[model samples]
Target: MSLTGHLAASLHDRGLGGDQASAARALRAVHRAMAELRRGTPVLIRGGDHTLIIAAAETVSARGLSELGLAGIGPAVLLLAPVRAAAVLQRPVPQDAPGTEAGAVALRLPPALLDPAVLRSLADPTAERLLPAEPERVGAPALASAAIALAKLARLLPALVAAPAAEAASGRLDLLSVEAGHIAAYPDTAAGTLTRVAEARVPLEDAPEARLVAFRAADGGIEHLAILVGQPEQALAEGSVPLARIHSECFTGDLLGSLRCDCGPQLRGAIKRMAEDPSGGVLLYLAQEGRGIGLVNKLRAYALQDQGLDTLDANRALGYGADERNFWVAAEMLRAVGIGRVRLLTNNPDKLAGLAACGIGVEGREAHQFAANGVNDAYLQTKARRFGHLLT
Candidate 1:
């Protein structure tokens, strides 16, 4: 197959293409736009009847805003992470307002007041400002564009965009063009080259027989760790469906014992449980910190949680989905180790779905849960309620 044909096939597998050819074109367009946003460059986003030029609010400049305004794009509004919005706006957000969905709040500021200082301040994660007395016109497409831009820039999911327009506008804005080759190359580049970098005997407090194996991607994007307990390779060799747990990395709870979530206990507990099993198990430690939004945004979500938002709400407020992880890497790691099937251990149905979608067979599920602590009670409840995580 040609390079274009291969790219289209991959995009189709990812559900981002209509067909191989069209998918290749779409991938090129979206990939170029995403790359532009990552570099703090403004890009044009159009959907439905709206077209807007947007950049990541975290890095967007007064000059950038001025450029968009000169091109008839602004008085700029910010589509903020829910917690950031609440802090910056200095008021309780109304439940019925537009841009309130997914813990996101859009505030349109006066173009006249948007001096360089103010624009720079908006870029700070900790900075706060008063919202305008009256609402700014934020339509759905603008919100979507902001979401998409932020997702690419921050590695968050469910992208959205925000503009300074007080009302919806119609027209085609030809600001940039992308080639199919560029689009086809992104997925290939992002998939990276996965290679096992290290392996060693790592006796854990709970699982003394554990072995740690590390796999690094060529892009240095994320490194996946496999914690093998009780000879999983031997068990699989004997045709036993070894147990498996796919855990996303959590810096706060896993490392700091943050009571806001149950990640640490789950990590330790999974190892302990596998230690008792004669057949053993594998725990794939993914580098998808904060559900693929990275650690900084997780802290931003923590701030929103302090404002009484639930976990899902906090993520949404930050312009991310409830969960943004994809399990293809887990499947690949499993395949690399010569494992074909397993009894998956998880509370998240999405994990099972993700692995299955990536062609890994889950023969059964071992329900895993930890008793909720005082700080994480609401967090656990939110997971079960909003994200459909199975818990008792």
Candidate 2:
């Protein structure tokens, strides 16, 4: 039988649906591959008619690169997102360029650029001094694009060192193998598998009556939190839309009280507002640090900010989108807790539209603006001007 038919038959033998089970298995493989990538270990990606061994450019060491080279048949290559490739090559790569996602600019890696430091400089735009090299742009294997995607999922820089794998390298080298198609399908597949796993009454300073619900995907990845304050479920039961806020977790701002942005104030202030509201509210604290580029990359962006690049531009320069937080996870969490309609507490118009697109009924919006401290005035202005936040 065909691959699809075989997968369906195996899932049926285990009493599971074909699509969901296949996606779950694929997500688990991708999850393990991400861990391997983060630890600087090379992973073998198997696509149709091709096999490649790839390592994260951010974490891979000289030893790891050498070992990857030893195991692979062809010359090693560096795969970079178009934006980052542009920065490294000092050329223009239009965002609207066709085939951007389908392929990446593969720079043939020379012996001098194989060091960890040089690889990092090529991946990171905020590097102090980029090493000079004659980079030849070539169309990388289709799997190279997915390899970069895997690095992004690991919260690393969207750059990877890849080489064509030796024959039967998966068995000979004992490398973790992941399908490129699975890496491509990871986001939606993981989001679709988000289930409310655990919850408890976690009282907060502002919201005394609060319960924290945790949602985890089937692959056992990061959990998104739902802070139900002042009986939001009850409000939903009574046909009153609860106040809702989708807060992306900011490590520096929320925990360390860093004044780089208004995240701490917004997080605390949103809870207080919900507690005071008679209709109650739910706060979805998504584990999307640095607007989904992860914490370390966020620090890199902070370094870029010191050089006068705004928040959005810094992220783009780092080969990431302006905001990579997926609100589909938020919508799934809300649905699990029986909340389909909400009066969202946010200044960003994107939140309103994001929920609406995910089939969540946004009854209205409540402004949850916080006054800018002296340090965050310019940052707040960037939010309003560049991110189109509705700040008054």
Candidate 3:
């Protein structure tokens, strides 16, 4: 079978088929739409029961808008962060306002402003904004699905904006079709069936006895790493449960030493702790940045955080659930390395639950915590309060 066909079959086996297929498909479409929007291309988004051409307000061009017949139909509505929304709309959006709960607001602009120059400003990436001018009436469930998809893409709260289905299908505007269901299945299956593509000894500043092993997904969507400290293989060979830490990749915090979260400390702390342990450990370095929202969206959430929203609320305001990460990849990595059980290191209970769900035995959890600084105090508090993270 071709690689695509093999991936499709694998996805189908991972519970993305049958009744759940629509939701999966919708998610894939959202991802595709996000990619297209990033390139300043408009995409056909099916929301409610209507299909609408949607693009990021920062990148949408006057020509792109005209191609979708948006200018001829009517004015476009801009969805944006409440602070920016209030600033742009020149109206006060009460904190207690109904839709303001998501920290986002939408404003309908005059159709006259759909020109290229105006659109370039509207689609500014630094400016938190979204344009939804056209709408086709669809069912509430469908609209909700589309909203969630859009939120995941923009990493902001959900907003209402879409192009008409008929206009989208007219072939003038470039429409990227999404096989969302198939794509959604890729992650789960990939986690279970990752192939080790490369491995090499890479000494870190603290953990000099570390070796990095890379695993590629069958569908080629994502890659995960297993950083072995000490002789994890030898430990496992002797029937010992190797210590392990499933650390999600954090560019801002891990790379830049940002104190907004405890990720950096936890990462280094885990490696240091493992280096000291006689059994050593394996740090499954996951590429699930920003709890799986990706780097740019995480920054968008940071902007929302600056506006007084907690970590969880910031993600929700951007149309995401509290945690979008999965631990199947970590579980699969452990299994691949011949370790069935582990002394998992983490403060989050979800990690335990996720690993357990994936059939990995968690022998025990080593309490992992870093001293709270002023910047991360609120963040730590929210993790404890909202997500039930084990932090004291």
Candidate 4:
């Protein structure tokens, strides 16, 4: 019951080839795929750069998707955005049509998905509104809405290119825009109607501290990440400048200390370190469980792992490859606290890569490993070997 089994089970439930399959099975397939990526379960995609995957995902609409078939359109529509990039020529796409890259990226959608109606629902405004919202939302209408959203984003890309300069000029959050190249505001920072810049960093005492404290993410979900702060001011220059234990939500390891993984100790260790450090680091416990995949699907992957699937195989078995987490909110928390450079504490190199790419720097990275036990040895080895963790 590796990830593939999970997916086959899900497809079985879809009535795609089912009389015995259940809808929950399909949901788990979607779940494992997303969480695998988010949690840094490593695997390569189509031999291209990771940004291509991210760029495609970014270009798609994030709203309203229940059916795996309907939501699958996002990645499909997203593949077009990177073609305009200069690097795309450096890494030319294969002889595939626009949406085909998305299909190749996430091979869940049928090849018939190349239909113009699917493309139109994604692009046509009227069809987008007509996109089925409830029961009828699974097929063409969902694809239609994705098509429209992607088209809208594409239309807005040029303007979006200039949005950073405008956003930083008028943020009340304690964020500094020193580097001209990366001056975008925090993803959660309020925009619109205001266009003023901060002269300098505003901390406690003379100036007011924004309520960034209230945004802590404490949860019982699947993925877990921790943000430890040795020095906050070096990274960002925002109001209240929060140091955080940024954990992705994980259901099994964090709560149950599942031997299949070591997420629990890392999370607790993050809290302990943050609490001890005294830099006022906020533990932003995330609700994006199983890397936003939810609980049941993780169990499904476990079942697959028992069936001798490697991590990536587990996800692919479930019908997805690795990685699906977004760091906008994590970036926001850093911005809210006025941190410019961070002394990040983690073993995962991709976290460093992703955060740095998103505009945060690892001025330093420290490794964190909980006590090793009999249960999670293979799991830790898998994470360390395949995903590139700095094992201790």
Residue ranges of candidate 2 with Cα displaced over 4 Å = 1-20, 95-103
lDDT of 3 by residue, 1-392 (tens): 32234334443466534444454454455456666666656666443354545555545665566655642244345455444444344455565565443434445556665565565455333353434434222222223234334545444333334333463463644477443333345456446557799999999888889999999764445689999999977997798877999898999888999989999899999999999898999999998889877887788789878988788867755545577666767878888877788889989877876676667788898999888989899999999998888988
Off by over 4 Å in 4: 1-101, 104-244, 278-280
- Selected candidate, larger TM-score, 3 vs 4: 3
Weakest 10 consecutive residues, lDDT, candidate 1?
164-173
lDDT of 4: 0.38
Q: All candidates: CA RMSD in angstroms?
A: 7.5, 5.8, 7.5, 18.4
* TM agreement with the true structure for every prediction: 0.70, 0.90, 0.73, 0.46
Candidate number achieving the greatest TM-score relative to the actual structure? 2
Model 3 TM-score on a 0 to 1 scale: 0.73
What is the C-alpha lDDT profile of model 1 across 61-139, one tens digit per residue? 5555555565544445555555445545556566456656444556665665455455445644334643355546353
By lDDT rank, best first, the candidates go 2, 3, 1, 4
Against the hidden true structure, what lDDT does model 1 obtain? 0.64
Off by over 4 Å in 3: 1-34, 45-53, 70-147, 150-160, 167-174, 183-186, 189-193
Predictions ranked by TM-score, top down?
Answer: 2, 3, 1, 4
Off by over 4 Å in 1: 1-12, 15-53, 62-109, 113-129, 138-153, 156-193
Residue-by-residue lDDT tens digits, candidate 2, 173-208: 677999887886677567778988899999899988
Q: Candidate 2's C-alpha lDDT? A: 0.82
State residue 210's C-alpha deviation in candidate 2, in Å.
1.1
